[model samples]
Target: MQGFTIIEIMIGLAIGLLTLLAIYKLFATSEGRRRTTAAVSQAQTAGALALFAIERDIRSAGLGFAGMDPAYLGCAVQAYKRTGRDPAQYSFPLMPVQIVNGSELRVLTGSSTNMFIGARYSASASGVFTMERSNAGFQAGDVVVGTSDTDPGNCLLMEVTAGAGSDITGPGGVAEDDPTVRHLSSGYTSFYTGASVTPERNGGSSVDMLDGGATSLGEGWLFSLGNRPTRNVWRVQDNQLMRYNFLDETDTKSVGVAEDVLQMVAEYGFDKDGSGKIDKDNEWTGVDAELVASKLDRLMAVRVAILVRSSQYERDAVTSAAPKWANGSKDFVMGSGDDWPHYRYRVYESVIPLRNTIWGQQQ
Candidate 1:
């Protein structure tokens, strides 16, 4: 039998090793391409889904509730939750005429958000508020905001904690969420005739109490804010788009809607002179100057941008430069912890008109 030379055996081994190395390289390249494509597709879907959700809500902003009238824009709301984790959650000046990322989008959403105030709600009383009739049109746990006939700017929010007749109490007045405390110890049935209410006294450029007593809220109109007002707030956290129903009155945390989201940017489109149109170049702004209560009425539309990042990692840099749009109005930014160039990004943008408020202006 003839034996093969050691040189021939060595050459055969080397050729086999080279072929295996080539196969491995091809596999790695194919796998990398597949992952990048999947990641890009996922980021695209997330951006679109998030944009659609936000757009739908912004387009339906306030519906017949807060967006029905321009006067209600930036309306001051004082809310109290029964089982709320934070005391400062429900009280603030809502509807600043624009919505943005890292910020909140608050809109009143429900079936019927209107009613008539029956009597004067003496600030001195608690546990009960009366409507035009004894019927409790407002069910228990319904969140209601009462507007003062004397001052529409001054509003009080309360949750019904009692049975039929829809009684309300000050904060801590109920076993749970009674905001009108007087309603808790309110003795009389049907309607509690508490101590006489004093009118608001002013001058000295300050709001004063008459007769050195708590000023009464002259009940004018009652707006049912629903059981736990839907004060929807949008946020971004942990590479996800988060939504916190700030007024749900529960200890529930914010829910995530989209994945791989980096950040969001939003701007305002104003009518300026109530032209029933938006002056994009002259009046579109993201600054706080337009955040004032007086400037809110001029708000016509909102421009929003949502950036989403691909989750796949590449060995080489994918993005060579920073991203910007609309003449650098929205500059793309990422946290320092990111290896940005190794990832891809997608931007979803739109200009949503404040249709409800805009219609109100046309009238």
Candidate 2:
């Protein structure tokens, strides 16, 4: 073979270098695409999980209160634990607790001390009390007294008989009997209020009315799926989604529950009848409890949209897209135009029945 010239050798080297560079670029492009697909999938999964959790809780909003007494519901009962008056003196402490105002559901569980300590003055109002008991063998109007003669702080004791005699004695007088007594347990107490009682912000009881002004209550009760107080608007700060109790005045900042929550949207489903449907006429407004009750089967659907913005991709590849519209653009947008910016949009929707409403009908 003839020896190759310097120019020929240089040309051959150039061709080889160009081919290698192209192969490297192809691999890099494939890797980038893989990562982008994974990011999108992850974001979708996260959004779906969040939406499901919210819907599950919302569906059970006002369950287990329709057949019970109004006082037990606590929505209609004004004061829960009496500090000065006698238990028998007043109407058996109409469920001594209520679900107050907050973004999430709140339930007031009385202190154990207040529930069983009988014959003692109703002075301290802060303690974990029992609200229901199936084994206590107590009726609807029986007083719950302290059975532990030694500790007096551990267990709740109930007087099986109602309106018999004053279990609590006062200054030269005996405590009266409460005709509306109800029992409760530790985990979750379902007071059998005949009518539904929605608590007001002022710590007073109101029937099917939500307090529009008040912000915080020591025992602010919000009824959701499992009778535990839950927050609605969770905050995402410092790359974390946190849970905040709007009723907790002390906890200005909430605790983090999830991370990387880019967006969340909530929609109220107005079931005009117990039959679930999205009737325009039966939507939730400031007035109309009947509509609320009849629509008690109302469903709350939460749509959580999240963006998985990671540092792995090149910023130049990102594009600004238009937002997707659901429930119409007019309901969510301001101004009479479509000049709004919508970027890479993903939505997840979850429907939950308001378990706390009489309309739910099904537990």
Candidate 3:
């Protein structure tokens, strides 16, 4: 038998090593690509879910009784306590669309009303008054609005306490009736006998006509009162989108809506010209968020921006692309600074019009 030469044996071993190395490289490349695609998909899913939730709420911001205006939709009434004796006992006023320097968002929703009870059973300026409707749906601690029966345009908002025999009270919570405390007109009048009465809850209330009556309260467009999921706050904390509903008694704890949310920025759009339409060029983009907030009643649209990130780390040692947004005076970034290459990111944006605001404009 002829023995193999040393040169030939060495050549065969070298070729085998080269083939193995090529297979390993191919596998590595394929795995890296797979991981990248998954990360991108995750980011997209998270961003889409977050945007959808926000848009839904924004669109329904001022929805309430028929003909209710959006301008009156955003008022933060004290959150109701689930375990308390009275859920509406401790709520105070909070803005409907409250933004913490453009970082977080708070929204108020309106609860529907049962039919209007009859006119004031008896009238007195004292916070309490009588109604023709039974106390079946109406209860103590319910927020109700009283309007003029003759000029339904004249209205006063009050809380129900100690309901019995068609009697409802607690306007301004004053035992002794004060004519000066009237939100509609001094002294409760028989004119409210047939006025509309609607419930106000879930961060929604009828427009308190400070200058008296703006228009006649329409038929069936009256008072509303009830316990409902009418308000909540949305915010990004610890890379999670959390919702807090003070009005809900069952779940008082903050719940996470989505994950990997880095930041949220919103801009208010207005129909500054009173032309019944919102245009970007005429929007108030002031750096001071409070100024924009002051004009919330006039706001016609809202522009929201959300930043999302991948849940897993990418293997790349360096990356040339990163996400960015112009937030206020600073450039908002994702996976920015020294850790830019470790993750992937995306930005989701939407502009929602305020139906309530538009309705008010038309009136």
Clashes of each: 15, 49, 20
TM-score of each: 0.72, 0.48, 0.64
What's the true lDDT of residue 268 in model 1? 75
Over 4 Å off in model 3, which ranges? 3-7, 65-95, 113-226, 249-252, 280-282, 286-295, 315-336, 360-363
**Candidate 3 residues 1-363, lDDT tens each?**
998899999999999999999999999888888877887787788889998998888776544332333333333333323242244434433233445567767665555354322233333333334333433444444444444444432343454433422322457764532212122212222222433333232122333321222353222112343334255678888888888764543234678998888888876676666665665454645333543445455667777888887776766644465555543333555433667667777788877776644563455
lDDT string, candidate 2, 31-91, tens digits:
8778767766766666666555545544533333332322223222222222222221111
Candidate 1 stretches greater than 4 Å from native: 67-72, 88-90, 96-104, 111-142, 160-219, 249-252, 326-329, 335-338
Tens digits of per-residue lDDT for model 1 on 1-363?
999899999999999999999999999999999999999999999999998998887775644344324454465766554343455334556463345432445544444344322223433223344444343445444445555555656555554444344344547676343333222322233222333322111111111211112454334444554443465677677888887765553325878899988887777778776566874486777665455534676777777788889999889988876667445665676656558888998888888887755654445
- The candidate 3 region of ten consecutive residues with least summed lDDT is 178-187
| RMSD in Å for all candidates | 8.4, 13.0, 9.9
Query: For each candidate, what is the lDDT?
Result: 0.58, 0.34, 0.53
Worst 10 residues of 1 by lDDT: 201-210
lDDT (C-alpha) at residue 298 in model 2: 43
User: Distance from true position, residue 286, model 2, in Å?
Assistant: 11
Ranking 2 against 3 by TM-score, winner: 3
